[model samples]
Target: MQEGCIEWKLDEKENINSLEELARHGARVMLRIALNDEIKEFMEKGETLRDEEGRRLVYRNGYHREREIQTGIGPIKVKQPRVDSRKAEVKFNSKILPKYMRRTESIDAFIPILYLNGVSTGDFSEVMEGLLGKGKGVSANTVVRLKAEWEKEYAEWRKRDLSAKRYCYIWADGIYLKHRDEEDEKSCILVVIGVNENGDKEFLAIDSGIRESALSWKEVLLGLRERGMEEPKLAIGDGGMGFWSALREVYPQTREQRCWVHKTANVLNQLPKKLHPMAKKMLQEIYLSPDKAQAERGIGRFVNVFEDKYPKAVKSLTKDAEELLTFYDFPAAHFQHIRTTNPIESSFSTIRLRTKKMRNCGNRKTTLAMLYKLSQQVEKGWRKLRGFKEIPYVLEGMPYLDGSRMENAVV
Candidate 1:
């Protein structure tokens, strides 16, 4: 406790001020050792302090380049040792290395792993092993453990405070995750995303199976309701069987917008490969028309023009015509944002690629964990995407939505 004197003790001791003193207090008797470089340097410069024995001594300063070579013991201050004039030797000893140094073989040794966009643990390991030196830091276990934490963090993130109604629009779309079932086969996992009132996004739900059944979608919607999302003013998604049914059951008043992009893809799929160019042009004319009426007119003309050669394409188009054009009645300015589920698709594309590497998810928990982590990671860096700002004016054009309230309901 004296000034300039080293005080040492174990971390539990809570009183030690120096490593040397701590070692001294331990069960094993050990001398506190230190090289006072400055004192040694002064001594090398012909400096001497009289000792009890009164012997002339020289202490040479040692350093690893610019770094000071430091070692010490509790302030008992033993006489400095003399070095052999013929042979000079210096040994380096580290008091303590980072804890990560101990578990070098385990993947978890890599702490505070930099989670990057479009980067995977496998890819990161490859970069460390192939590009950088492999044995320098953590082992395989460290990497797996870090990934497991990410997955766990993601699960916790999904359950975070969603009780408040800040989201103006809740767009729900299912991305099909490639998975395998009981027989060790391939299957699909449906992952849902929600755009909050502030235009921020989050994972709404996740489920697995080949079919996105009504029951499955219903459960997802109900879960959202239970999680504090009472109802959204608008629920936009690609029209799937149980998807709409779930919406109706959960929020009958929610406005629906069918993804125009999916409809276009389906329509294009129905056309022959050679006619894709022509079909694309026709589809564009309908989608990009000046206004809702004009777009509708364009579709009518498209069907008439292609009826003979591509009857099936036109039929397919007709089936999804209303849903595809759902955004039309909303507001012309909002068309860009509501036209398609492309925003959700962008997320799906990344999810598909990440999960695609795995042959099959080990279990439902594992699958959900990965999706939750991946989605949360992506959302963290997401910016508020610009949508149709002019749509408010268009909404004013529709007298019904523009009205003070729809109070005619008997219920």
Candidate 2:
């Protein structure tokens, strides 16, 4: 060691601490110092401390409260200082640890993600315990309480007023979940998503149904009507869904578009495996065409190529020919969104993966609440559709010819 330089040595018995632990300890010390400084400033300004003529300002009462604040490292217990006011009304509130805040917002948000990923409510404590040390994690009772709050939120959301709401487009589908018990059949949950005039996607409805039957769908549509949801300009869905018949009965004027993705899969299912490659390409031509005439020509070529050898496949493709081609009449920029119910499909894909892992969700109410919570989480990532600005024209019943603006068309 040099004369001016200091020497370093390792302590034999001192506990080695990780960087995260040091950072957390530093934050705790700073927080306490900050709160004490706030109290000091109040005390200095107080009339009692200054011996002024006016009534006493805020003064130190005592440290009467203790709270555990959740941080990245773990939950930290802190003593909250109290204050007494004489003339000026004042309250001691630490910006670092807000009143009644058990966990940070980021930590609170993580709970639903864990729940949606198949972590049961009762097991949250175990999961958190692994992340945080023992005794410093969210309790199962807390998770159950949060779930009850979500149930109330979902109930309130379902009954909200939609009288002034109008959607430019709608997508309908029925999601089937595994049977609860061996004796019971699987259940269907009908879902509807809508695109408002601003082209924002919204989860409109999620209801229990019986295998997408006409009556089941009718009840859902009737509910929407009773809730004051105006008939959307166009509805997109799989042709096989019972939604079509019910939609026609409820909102007869609304145009329909069969989802090309569903149509492609249905057509491919009927064809031989060897023909799938060629058949899929042929189906793509019909949907990806530039205009209705081009699409029709593509369909004609498909029919000519497979009508004899694979009548079932060709029939499946041609059955919803008009509905499949409905996208060509809409704005070219919005054709991608209008051609399929992919938005709804993508969102439900998360639910499908979650439910598959869980095998069977609890009861109908519990299942709906979980689904609603999952949708709320998924909706955060949903981007606005392309050509969103053109939605207002669609809502005004503006017609388009070959994906071009048709001037002065009658509404």
Candidate 3:
């Protein structure tokens, strides 16, 4: 083949920008078809809705009103057809478009993502207008109403029954938002994510911290118990979370596992900057050991090396020694998955970023609702736990040695 000037294929008549307009038109047409079909089915071939006696029951009234429905593509003007029935109890209602709906459910969902992205309520119209169309976006008041709706959803989710659920692992975290005025020093959101027996992760709880941390965490655990959540097999969190105390009180049988990542950070914070790299590597060695016995040995090594110079760092390292090594008691394959609260952190990374940029989350209800909405969306993308098959053995309380069942261990 000889090199030559290339000619690209392009259709001069086909304007890509017009595709949206064509789609909008198509949506309107389809909406009419569906509405008409609903009416035809309601009235049937009888010309007017009637009973077997041929008595008139329903007749087309008229369009309720022409209104604009905000959608992801753009706003489309729609006319919801109406009908009146001879029976006072009968009426025509469009399932396709409810009487009070002004926007698509997708639009309702999109607003919160924007809100989480640090878009203020006042900025919603301008931002949506640019994404939607100049004259087709929702108002700030609409955003306010959506907030009320989300609060209701959060309220309902908080009260949901969890009695039939059993989780193999649960991760807990307390997230403190940076506020505008730095109002409450203790304000934080306590989040819990659980891994069910099927190895699927799900949100178990998201509650705003109440008063004393021990009491607040206790309340969260007690709430889970009340809602029928059986005690999880393992609970992973940072050592400092008052969650451990609450866990002991609420589910005494559940095992505790301190996050190695948080543990490393806590220990390093006590050591000199010059020694951080070495100290961190030693901490990693302890947690990354092949088995519990070696892990305990690694801890002893870490202590012997640093106890004289960095007693504080060694103290932090040894204080939660048992919890840090708890991952070894489970299947080897699950060590990576359960050793840290990374699952929880990664899930809320976006929300944390947005919430950090926001000076004030308004109120506890608003903040919780906003976080809940984002999590609801985030949960859809979660993958089943790795080594999910090993969950059954753990649930059965079988003894694990070096990440293998005792029976499966070599002689």
Index of the highest-lDDT prediction: 3
> The CA-based lDDT of model 1 is what?
0.56
Query: Candidates 1 and 2: which is better by lDDT?
Result: 2
Instruction: Name the regions of candidate 1 deviating beyond 4 angstroms.
Output: 1-127, 136-138, 180-184, 351-363, 387-411
lDDT of 2 by residue, 1-411 (tens): 779753443345434388766556666666777788877776776645432665555767788578877766776667878877754545556675667888775677667667655677788888887766787778989988888887888888877677776888999988877645444346788899988877688888887788889899999888888888898889999985589999999999999999999999999998889989998998887888888999999999999998988899889989899999988778999998989988888977866777687746555665677678777867778889799888888888889987887877876
Q: Would you estimate the TM-scores of all the predictions?
A: 0.61, 0.77, 0.76
In the range 1-411, model 1's lDDT, one tens digit per residue, is 789865544557346666655553541212223334433454564445434576544434343222211122212212333332211332222322211233222122222222322344455555454422343433457657756776777566656666874444556666555433465244445666665645556666655544666787788777777788756656678768778887899878777877777877888888888888987888888888766678788889988888998898898888877767666555444567667776667865754665566454444555556555556556766766354343233323322222122335332
Worst ten in a row by lDDT for model 1: 66-75
In angstroms, give how far residue 197 of model 2 lies from its true place.
1.3
In model 2, which range of ten residues has the least summed lDDT?
Answer: 6-15
Residue 110 in model 2: lDDT: 68
RMSD of 3: 7.3
Pairs of residues at least 3 apart in sequence or in different chains that clash in candidate 3: 180-359
What's the lDDT of the predicted structure labeled candidate 2? 0.80
lDDT of 3 by residue, 1-411 (tens): 348732333245534368887777767777887888988887774365568899788888787889988888898888878877878777767788888888787777678767755677898889898989886667999889989999999999999998776789999998876433345533878999999888889888889885428889999999999999988889999986578889999999999999998988888899888998888888788778887888899899989999998899889988888888888888998999999999888977776777666644555667778878877877888989998999988888888878988976443
Give stretches of model 3 more than 4 Å off. Answer: 1-110, 116-118, 179-186, 408-411
